[model samples]
Target chain A: MSGLTLIASYPKSGNTWLRAFLASHLRDGRPIDLNADLSEVPNLTSRSLQDCHAGLEHSDLSRQEVALLRPLTSRRIAREQPGFYKTHDSNLVPPGAREPAIPPDAIDRVVCIVRDPRDVAVSAAAHFGWSLDDSVDRMADTAFCIGHSPRRLNANVEQWISSWSAHVESWLDAGGVQLLMLRYEDLLADPLESFTQLCRFLDLDDTRHAVSRSLEESRFSALAGQEARGGFRERSRTSTAPFFRAGKAGEWRTALPAVLAERVVGTHSRVMARVGYG
Target chain B: MTDGLLCGWRIRSDIALPELLDWQGDDRIPDLVVRLGEVDERLPEGREISPLLQIDGTGAGLLQVPMVGRFLVRPSGGITIAPQPEASEAEIRLFLLGSVLGMVCHQRALLPLHASSVAIDGGAVAFCGPSGMGKSTLALRFAQHGHSVVSDDICVIETCEPPRVRPCFPRLKLWRDTMEDAALSPEGLERNRRGQEKFHFRAPHAGVREPLPLRAIFLLRRAGSGEGEGIQRLAAPLDIMAALEAETFRLQVGHALGRAETLFQARALIANDVPVYRLTRRADAQPDRWLDAIAATIRG
Candidate 1:
């Protein structure tokens, strides 16, 4: 049992695919269908506030008083047993509201999947049921810089493009943690190879055959089926919403209205160029 | 390049960094590294480097904390400002810096605690809980009433021999929703650059109080319909040990038996020697009642 490995991604990034691949590998090439038994390791993100409170009461004496000063504080806890934890939030300095949710210092390794912002905007729009223009607009608000100031800094697509770069930068800066960046398109192109590399970085033996059984083209179909049946969404312990949405990369091409697509390309041209997407 | 002074405890890394990078490259190396105080324009490259909490000094310990992410020059020429990372802006960077620093330091002198600490009548009181448990809100409420806040969200717990837990650092962090709920004005809170999500409070030290003889440890929760009822005092040292460790342990500091762990265990042993109470408060009700109960316990 080592520390928890976090598969972190911006929402709608290829986090689910990575998680599925790893899960499949860990399960030894078994088809981790919708009926997979995830009772052993629960989703911290989906865990209900009520469940956490109730669960605390039944804790053994060691858990009752174990001080969690660091977000990765559960390294010891995981050393006793390794579990997979996934999160969308970035690591914080003073342990912001989200970081404290898990034991600080508990994350032994982090796998980040970065996609072109254009693709991300398109993916985000479809998931949130927003129009392409609306998604691009939202991404441009530069994280909604509507703080107390009247002058809203109009950060166009450049800011959105830099968002992922900034995120990966922070993770790398924080030493003792290994970060693996995977492009969404690259993952979509070759699921098995992508997952195998991910496993190697995570230090998990690739013998699990997670990709072999899942197949390539069927991966998306299976994921789509899972999403249709609300498999990934169901796995979420929290009642927030379904997680699996459209997993396509170039969805913005047709899905994004022509005008909005131009605005996205226009604004994030630098960023798009960086990821070789523009 | 300005002279860099080594702080209280200096850790030098063998890994050399490019002459310039955003923030300090390593938390284990030293707290602050300064090239140019306010005039420095070098920003950390790559997405991983955060703008908050840079290492600046004559060399190492002799340093300045940036004010509102800007260097504030003191009239007396002592430019030591405590820069609280904008919660909404650099949440991840700040969090990671604190986590890494807290880890490499080995919880020896600086222990990270998943609790909120506030200076109260001649001592400090810490409320420990997990996320969504309202630790920041509780601490902010007390701070508003003139109780000096030592740390919010995460408190660096420093312990001396004989086992006294002292909170180092002055700041409180709140979610956007919590700030709204607590009615705290966001005029002063800093916004993060990347995500318009969270905010950080720059706490001003107003009241003078001693490192409280660990007052009382309360594991908080939003009381439900039926749960542990009433205010019951936990008498067993073992029970106290269990509860305190769960709430206060910094696992990132590594080692199953670090000095900080030993000190914390020792403090809990003494705390178990003291009074431990469970205050079941209405989730809908204010935290005042629990505060009053803690005061009474401390007094008695």
Candidate 2:
């Protein structure tokens, strides 16, 4: 059986933070280079991986064709070894495609990290350089997507995030793969507990000391310091804001406008209630 | 050997490649022979091979291209194409234009760059990058600005005393978005294939049949926030070599075919003779703006 575990999330959720934690924990006290060390958890939708399987460039394929072939390509990638992949795409099957974005049988485990849609809106707005209202509206849209750049091919796959509620519901209801859900607020409130639980889910050593050490190393300050010293490669080339901007969970109260927050919450009220965000 | 000119080579093919402009009317002796025949699923055991291609000890190799066909290329400049039974004429035509032609160039010891070029001031300037980096789109912009397109996708370079680039087909494949951006209706243009939204636009002017002296090579890269859109000359030899290596079509396949030394020699020769520049553009930058900038750099 293949050993493919996914660190799945919506955009601007705590996906990167979780990766940082896992990377630091796995390194066992070695200094973590946010850019270099994080290579272990590669993007699931990497163009290079797809190109290797397709025997042609991803740019040669239309978006629909790419989506259709992603499952097979991902399965091939997973066959190589046990590895973790980061994905922001929802679990929904692409329109007119039979299978979901991440094929069920290809993945062994999925660790889904979710943040409040309001907070996600604020962070997404900053990360993508969209206005707060625009970001909120996108979060409410059922066809919301990222990495649909018109001028150039994106390194990552076109993620179909849909709406905030739909994105969360799809993953939660996803079949076949083992699911372990984690909330950003819980991680912020108690990193040691949350990450230790995550470690256990991933079948890694969850010793208290290891968890504490990884938490210390992957602290927002550490990641921000590294980005400050040498810029983050994953940062959007267009965005002026730092990739690790404002890692606080509830900053949306002050950062996101009241109307935008209400819009996100209203749009995602049912899922928000289910996830304890309501 | 049969007789015809293909990418400046006199060749004969059993399968009629109508996409290639008929350069010979069965008169001249051929430098290469291409026939349709059975190709093995895999190369003979213990041979050097890429995932998609393989080369025997004698430089004969097989290319297993998806959807189009399996091709066996011989060291003696002969080729055998075993197209999939269901493959359409369009599919075979496209593969012949791209990968098959590229492999033939590699077998012939020519450098087939993953680039598109246009004739500027009697010389060919090329835009090179991975697919979807706007190489053809930029070349179309150049053609629209009245420059003659030297090649559409693969720019075949013969590394001589001064390397020269031979033209391929005179068609530019543009995505629907790019066509709309250029304000051209996609009404009559041929889609790259039936289902794909990419359309092939024939250049208004014919592709240059004669090889032109190579002038400048620009490696297309996405601009960072700190870097503005423009052309920056690559002064370092290593950088020039790196750029050339990055854009060489089927480089891994070339290595598998035991042509690594030949490819290296070609890269060195071209790097020494040509001025390589890095053309950086923002994702949303206007094509005309950067086209003008690239033209100015090439003219200089």
TM-score of the candidate numbered 2? 0.73
Segments in model 1 whose C-alpha atoms lie over 4 Å from true places: A1-11, A27-119, A126-131, A137-241, A262-278, B1-114, B117-125, B129-133, B142-177, B186-215, B219-265, B268-271, B274-300
What is the clash tally of candidate 1?
Answer: 55
Deviation of model 2 at A271, angstroms:
10
Q: Write the per-residue lDDT of candidate 1 for residues B139-258, one digit (tens) a residue.
A: 877776767776565554445543334544455655566666667666656653333435666565542223455565566755543334356677777777677666653442223223
Off by over 4 Å in 2: A1-6, A10-12, A19-42, A52-54, A62-85, A89-111, A115-155, A158-181, A192-278, B1-4, B11-19, B24-26, B30-87
Interface RMSD of 2: 4.8
> Where is model 1 chain A poorest over a 10-residue stretch in terms of lDDT?
A152-161
Q: Report the lDDT tens digits of candidate 2 across residue range A1-115.
A: 3567999998889999988888888788456888778877877776655565544565554566566666666666677645888898789987755687678877889999889
Q: Candidate 1 residues A1-278, lDDT tens each? A: 36777777666677666666655666665565543433223343432321222222111101111112223223333554467765654443321123332343666777767777677777666565666676777666434211021122111100111244444444545567677877889887876687678767867675434446644423767767765653442332322334555666787777667887787667767655765675
In candidate 1, the second chain superimposes onto the true chain B with a TM-score of 0.62
